[model samples]
Target chain A: MSDRDLIIDRYKDLLKTYLKGKSETALYKGQQFSRKLIEQQISPDDVLSDHVSVLHELFPDMSEELKDSFDFLLEVMIGYGFAYREHQSLRTRQRQLESEIEVAASMQQTLLMSDVPTVDGLDIGVKSVPAKKMNGDYFNFVKDHKSVSIAVADIIGKGIPAALCMSMIKYAMDSLPEQRMQPNLLLENLNRVVEQNVHPNMFITMLYGLYDTDLHEFYYAGAGHEPGFFYRASEDRFEDMFAKGLVLGVSRQTRYKEYQLRVNLGDMIILLSDGVTECRTSKGFIERDEIVDLIRAHMHKPAQEVVESVFNELERLQEFELRDDFTLIILKRKV
Target chain B: MNIQSCVEVCNEWDIVSARQLGRNMAKELGFGNVDQARITTAISELARNIYLYAGNGKICIEAAEKMGKRGLKIIATDNGPGIKDIRKVMEDGYTTSGGLGAGLPGVKRLMDEFMIDSVVGSGTEIIATKWLR
Candidate 1:
C-alpha cells in the first residue's frame, strides 16, 4: 500500500479503538495522522474520505447501524467542543457579576455606622440585620460636648441603589454644620439633599433627635418615621411618641413635626424601623402589647440584653427567616 | 399528587431542618436539579422571612398534579402584621425595613407559580409552586 493508504489504514484502526475505550491513544494517533497528512500536502476532506474508505474495507462485517453511530459520535464530539468553550465564557460572566455584588455589599457596610457614638448621660445601643448582604436601613449617633444627636433612616428600596442613597444620607448627615441642632431643621436639610440626589421613585423615612444633657430635654422630629416607644419607668407604662411628617424626597416642601419630652431619670427611649413592629408571630401578629411584654421581660436587663431579647422573641414567633431588614436602637437614662 | 409535610422548632438554628424538608419534597416531586436549587432558595427565603419578620410561623409543603405534571408547593404562613402594601412589597428595592429587599420578590422570580395574601394588622400567607416536566 502507498504511504497515504498506510496512514489511513492505521488511523481507521485507532479510531475504532478510540470509540471502544482507548480514547487517549486514539487521540494521539489521530493527531500523528493529521501531522503526517499535512506534511504530505493532503487536504482534510481527502484524509476524511480515506479514513472512511479504509474503515469500510477493514470492517466489512460492520452493520449500517454501527456506521451511523460512529457518525453521530463525531457530530457530538464537535458540538461538545463548541459547547465547552461557551460554558467557560458563561462561567466567567457569572463570576464577574458575583464579584460586583460583593463589592457593592462591602461598600454598603462602610456606609453604615460601625460603632455607636459615646456620650455622657446616655447608654445607647443599636442592632441591625440585613436580609441580603447589604442593607438600606441605617442608624447613626453623633455627639459633641453640648448635645447628642441620634438619626435613624430607612431608604425606600434595597440593593445597590438603596445602598447608594444610604451612603448619600450618611455623608449629608456627617457634613451638616453643628448649628443644625434642631431635628426639624436637620430633616428639612436632609430632605433637600436627598431630593436633589436620589431617584424620584425612591424615598426615605427618618427620625432625627437632639438631646441636651445640661437642659435635661430631648427634641425630636419625624419625617414619615414610625412612632417611637418610650418606657417611662416612673409611670410604669409605655407611651407612644407619635410625630408625623411626609417621607423625605416625596416633596421638597414636606413639613416635619417636632416634639419635645423631658428626659427624666430611669426612662428608656426606643427608636426602631418598621422591621420591629412589623415582626410576625405564630399566633397571628405581633401587637403593641406583645412588644411591651418583650421589653418588660428584658427591661431590667442591660440595654444590650433588651435589644437582643426583642430580636430573640421575634425570631421565636416567626420560627423562620427574616423577610426584611431589622434595625433597633435603644437609649436608656441612668437613674 | 397531594403531598404535605411539616416541622416545628423553637430555635432559629432549626431553620435548616425546615429547608431540608422542603428541598426533599421538591426532589420527590420530580423536580430537576436546577429546579430543586430554585425551590430550595425560595424555601429558604420564605423560612427566613418567617423567622425574622413574623418571629415564629409554620411552613407547609404540598405537592399537587398541575398541567399534567407533578408540582411542588410551599406555603409560609405567618401571623405577623402582614404587608401594608403588596405592590410595594413586590416592587424591586422597596423595603419597609432595611436590608436588600429581595425576599418576597426573589421567591416570586424563582418559582413557577407565586401568590401572596396579606392583610395589614392581620397576617401574611405566601404560596409558591414549581412544576416538574
Candidate 2:
C-alpha cells in the first residue's frame, strides 16, 4: 500500500478503537497518528474526509443528515486550508524579505562609512536614524583647508534601490575636489549625475553648505529641500534660512542658487531632513516653532549634546518609534 | 458580465481576500496578466492602507461600463482618523508608517483612473478604475 493508504488504514483502526471506547489508550494512539499525518503535510480537510470514509464503512446504517454534516465540515475545512496556506506563504516571504533587507542595510552602512572631521572654530554635530532597517536619508561631511562642507540628502524611494543610489552619490561626490567647496556648483553637478543615472521615478532633495572658518561665513544651497534655521546668538532669536531650487534628477539643466550667512560668535546653523520638521505626534505634526523651541531649550549645551537632546525629545514625542528616517546636523561657531 | 464583489478588510486575511477578488474580477473582465497583476497590487495597497491606518474598512470591486468602454472599478472606504494633508500624502517618498513610501502614489500609477476624498476626523474614500484595452 502507498503511504496515504497505509495512513488511512491506521487512521481507520484508531477511529474504530476510539469509537468503541473513549479510552485514554485510543486517544494517545490517535495523537501519535496525527503527528505522522502532520509530518506527511496532510491538512485538516483531508483528515476529515478520511474520517468520513472510515465512518461510512464502520457504520453502514449512518443517516444521510450525519453524512451531510461531515461533508459541510469538510467544505469549511477546505476554505480554512487555503487561507492557512496563504498565511504561511506570506509569512515566509515576509521573513525572507526582512533578512535580505537586513543584509543590504548592513552593507550600506559599510559602503557609506565616513568620519566626522575635526575642524577648529566649528563645533559640528550630526545624527541620522532610520525607522526601519534601511535608511533613505544620507549625510556626509568633507573637510577642506580652513573650511568644512556638509551635504544632507533624502531619496524619494526606500529599500535596496535607495541604498544603492546613496552609495553611487557617495562615490560620485568623493571624486570631485573643487566642486565640494562651492554649494551651488556641487548641487548642479550632482543633479546632472542623478538625472543621467538614476531612475526617472526617483528624485533626491539635498542641502549643501560650506562653512569658511577664516571668513566666518556659511554658504548654502538647496535642491527642493527643507529650509533650516540660523540661530542668531547675539539677538537670541532664530531666523529661517530658505533656499529655492528644483529637486535633483528632474532635469539636467537645473541651476541652484547659493545663499550666504555671516556666522558670528556663538551663532548656530541647523540643517535637517523633513523627518525632523514633519515629526508626527499624538496631536498632529509638531510645528517648526516647536523644533526651534526645542533647540532653544538645549542652546546652552555643546553642539553634539544639542543635537542629541533634540533627537531624544522628538523621539520621545513619537513614543520612541520613528515613522521615517530622521537626520539632523548642527554647525555652531564656538570661537 | 455582472460582477459586484465586496470584501471586508479588517485584518491580513481580509487583504488577501480583497486582492484575490480583485484579480478574479479583472481576469473575468478580459484583462491581461500584466493588468491583472497591477489591479491586484493596487487592491493590496488600498486594503493595507485601511488595515494599517484606519484599523478596518471595506473594498468593493465591480464591473463598470462608462460610455462605450468596459472597466473594473475598485472602491475602498474607511472611517478612520482620515488624512491630515491629502496633498502631502500624494507626494512621493512621504510615508508616516515607515513603509516603502509608495502607498498612494504607487497605486495611482497602477490604475488609469483614481480619485480620493478624505476629511479629517470623518473618513476617507478612494475610487480607482482600470479599463480593458
Candidate 3:
C-alpha cells in the first residue's frame, strides 16, 4: 500500500480501537499514529476526509449533519493547509538568508580584524560592538616605527552591503602604506577609492589620525565623521576636536582638512562613532557633556578600564540594547 | 478593466498576502514578469513598513489608467506614530529602524511615481504608481 493508504489504514484502526473500548492505550496509539501522519506529510484535510469515510464504513448510518460538519471542517483544513505550507516555505527561506548573513558576519570579523598595537609612549584602548550581527562601524590601527595610525569609519548602510564596504576599506588601507602617515592625504586617497567603488546611494564618514611619538603630536583629519575629544591634563579641560570635511563617496575632489594637536604629558585623545555620543535612553540621547563627565569619573583608571567603564555606563543607560554600532578609541599619553 | 483589492497589514503574514495580491493583480493586468516582481516587491516593502513602524495599517492595490496608458497603483495607509521628517526619510541611507536604510527610497525607485503625505500627530499615507510600457 502507498504511504498515504498505510497512514489512513493505521489511523482507521486506531479510531476503531478507541471507539470500541475508549481505552487509554488506544488514545496513546492514536497520538503515535498522528506523528507518523505528520512524518508522511499527511494533510489535515486528507485525515478528516479519511476519518469521515471510516466512520461511515463502521456505522453504515452516520448522521447527515455530522457528515456535513466533517465536510465543512475538511474545506477549512484545505485553506489551512495552503497557509501552513506557505508559512513553512517563508520560514525556510528566512532561515537560509539568516545563515548566509551569519556566515558573512563572521567572515567580516575574521578578515577585517586588527590588533590593537602597543605604542611606546601611548596607552591605547579600543572597543567596537555591532548593534546587529553585521556591523556598520569599522576601526583599524596601522603601526610603524614613527607613528601609530588610527582610522574610525561608519558606513551609511547596514547588513551585508555595509559589511562588504568595510572589508573593502580595510583591504584598501592595507595595500596603501604611502598615505598612512599624512592624515589628510590618507583620507583624500581613501575617499577616491570609496567614491569609485561604493554604491552611489551609500557613503561613509571616517576619521583618520596619526600620533607621532617623536614630536608628541597627533595629526588628524575627518570626512564628515563624529568629532573626537581632546583632554588636556595640564589645563584639566576637554575640547571637542572638530574638523571640516565632506563625507566619503560624495565627491571625488573632496579635500580633507588636517589639524595637529600637541600631546601634553598625561593628556588623552578620544576617537568615536556617533553611536557613542548618540546613545539613546528612555529619557533621550546621552549628552556629550554627560559622556565627558563619565570619562572624567574613570580617568584615574587605566586606559582599558576607562574605555570599558564609559561603554558600560552608556550601555546601562540604554538598558544594554544598542541601537547603533558603538566604537570608541582612547589614546592616553603614558610615557 | 478596473479591479481594487485591499489587504490589512497587521503582521508578517499580511505583508505576504499583500504582495501576493499585488502579483496576482499585475498578472491579470498583463504586466510582464519583471513589472510583476517590481510591483510585488514595492508592495512588500510598503506593507512591511506599516507592520514594522505603524504596527497596523492597510495596503490597497488598484488597476489604474492615465493618459491612455495602463498602470497599477498602490496605496499604503497607517494611523500609528507618523514620520516626523518626510524628506529625511526619503533620502537613501536614512533609517530609524537600523535596517539597510533603503525602505522608502527603495520603494520610490521601484515605482514610476511616488507620493508621500505624513503628519506627525495624525498618520501617514503613501501612493505609488507604475505604468506598463
Candidate 4:
C-alpha cells in the first residue's frame, strides 16, 4: 500500500484502542498521532479524501449519500471525546474526595480511640460516637509534673465544620501556657482563641479539669458544658458539679469559673456531651438524673463498663438514629 | 476552645486518615487547592512509611503557628525498624521496600519543614509541616 494507506492503518489502530478502553491515556495517544499527521503537512481535507477513497475501495457498490457520512461521524466523535474526558476527571475527583474523608475519619478515630491512661490508683473509661463521618466531639488529656489535665469539648454543629472546630479547640488548648493549668484559666485562654477565630453562630461547650494525684483533689471548670456528675461513695449521694460560664466563641470577654472537688476513694466523675443526656425518650429529652442513676447503678463496675452501659442505654432510647455526636468519659479514683 | 492531642496507631487505615485529616485542615487554614493536594500527598507518603516499615504507628495532624504565620504539622511515629542509611533514603527513587521509592524524599519536597529521627532497631519518626499561604 501507499504511505497514505499506512497512515490510515495507524489511525485505525489508535481509534480502535480508544473505543475499546475509553481510556484518557489512549485518547491522548490518538491525539498525538493526529498532531504528527498534521506536522507531516497532511491537511484534514486530505485525510478525509483518503478515508473516502478507502471506503469506496472497500465498498465498491456504496452510494454517494451513504459515503458522505464520515464528516458527521467525526463531529460526533469530537463531542464524545470532550464529554468522556470530563466524566473521567469528575469520577477521579470524587474518589479522591471520598478517600480524603475516610482518612480524616481514621485520624479522628486514632486520636479519639487512644488507650485510656492507666493511673496508679485511678480507672478511666471513655466512649465517643460521631453522628457523621466528622465527629463534633473531642476528648484529650494533658499531663504536667504532678497533675493531669483532661478536657472534653463538643462543637454545636455537624459535619465538616464541626470536625474542624474540634481541631481548633485542640490546637488552642495545646498552645496554652503550662503555668495556666487551672481549669478556669485554661478555658479562658481557649475561649479567647475560639472567639477570635470562630464565627459567632458556632459555639463550643467544654469541660476542663486538672487532677492532682498527690492531693487527690480535682479542680474543674465548665464552659456552658453539661453539669458533671460526681458520686460520693461515703454519703451514697450524687453531687452535680456544675459551674457557670458562657460557651466558647459566644463572647470574647467570657470567663469560666472553676470549681473544686476532693476526689475520694471509689468516687466517680462522669462527663458527657448533650448527645447522651439529650437522648430523646418517648415523652421527650432524657433528663440528667437518668444518666446519673445509671452510673450510680454501675458504680461498682469498672470505668469502661460504666461508660459502655450508659452508651447502650442511650442507643436503646434513640432507636431511630443519633442526631448528634456522643461522648462519655468516666474517671474514678479507686483506692 | 478546648485542645489536646491523641496518639495511637492501627493499620493502613490510619495512614489514609492522616492524609485526609491533613488535607481537610489545610483547607480550613485557607490553603489553596494546590497546597491542599500537596499536603494530602505528603501525609500519605509519610503514613505509608509507618504502615510499611513499622507495621503500625500513629499519625498526628495539628495546626501550628510561628511568629504570625499559621500552618499544618504532621507527625508519624512508629516502632518499626529504623533506616540504616538516611542519606540514601533521602535520594529520590531509593526505596528498600520495593515501593515507588518516593516516600521520604517526596515528602521532604512537598512540605515547608521536614525533620526525621530514627534509631537502628527502636523505630522511626518523621515530622513534616506545610504553611498555608
Interface RMSD of each: 15.9, 12.8, 13.9, 17.1
Error of 2 at A252 (Å): 2.0
Write down the C-alpha DockQ for each prediction.
Answer: 0.01, 0.02, 0.02, 0.01
| lDDT of candidate 3 over B1-133, digit per residue (tens) | 7667999999999999998899888888897544566677779889989999999999999989998998899999999899998888876556666544237876776689999999887789999999997
lDDT of 4 at B41: 68
Q: Report the number of the highest-TM-score candidate.
A: 3
| Predicted candidate 2 versus true structure: per-residue lDDT over A222-305, tens digit per residue | 999989999998899899989999999999999999999999999999999998998999999999999999999998888889
The weakest ten consecutive residues by lDDT in model 1 chain B span: B93-102
Give candidate 2 misplaced runs (Cα > 4 Å).
A1-42, A46-64, B1-133
Worst 10 residues of 1 chain A by lDDT: A75-84
lDDT of all the models against the reference?
Answer: 0.76, 0.86, 0.86, 0.77
Q: What DockQ class does candidate 2 belong to?
A: incorrect
lDDT, residue A296, candidate 1: 85
Over the stretch A35-55, how does candidate 1's per-residue lDDT look in tens digits?
877666554334444565667
Model 2 over residues B1-78: C-alpha lDDT tens digits? 765789999999999999889988888889854466668878988999999999998999999999989999999999
For model 1, residues B1-133, the per-residue Cα lDDT tens digits are 3657875523576478777897788767676444565576677778877787777787888886765777888888888878877887775555544434245765776677899999877789999988775
TM-score of 3: 0.63
User: Model 4, range A131-243, lDDT digits (tens) per residue?
Assistant: 88889988887665677778888888888898877777777776886635678988888888988999889999999988998899999989999877888888988888787
TM-score winner between 1 and 2, please give it. Answer: 2
Candidate scoring better on TM-score of 2 and 4: 2
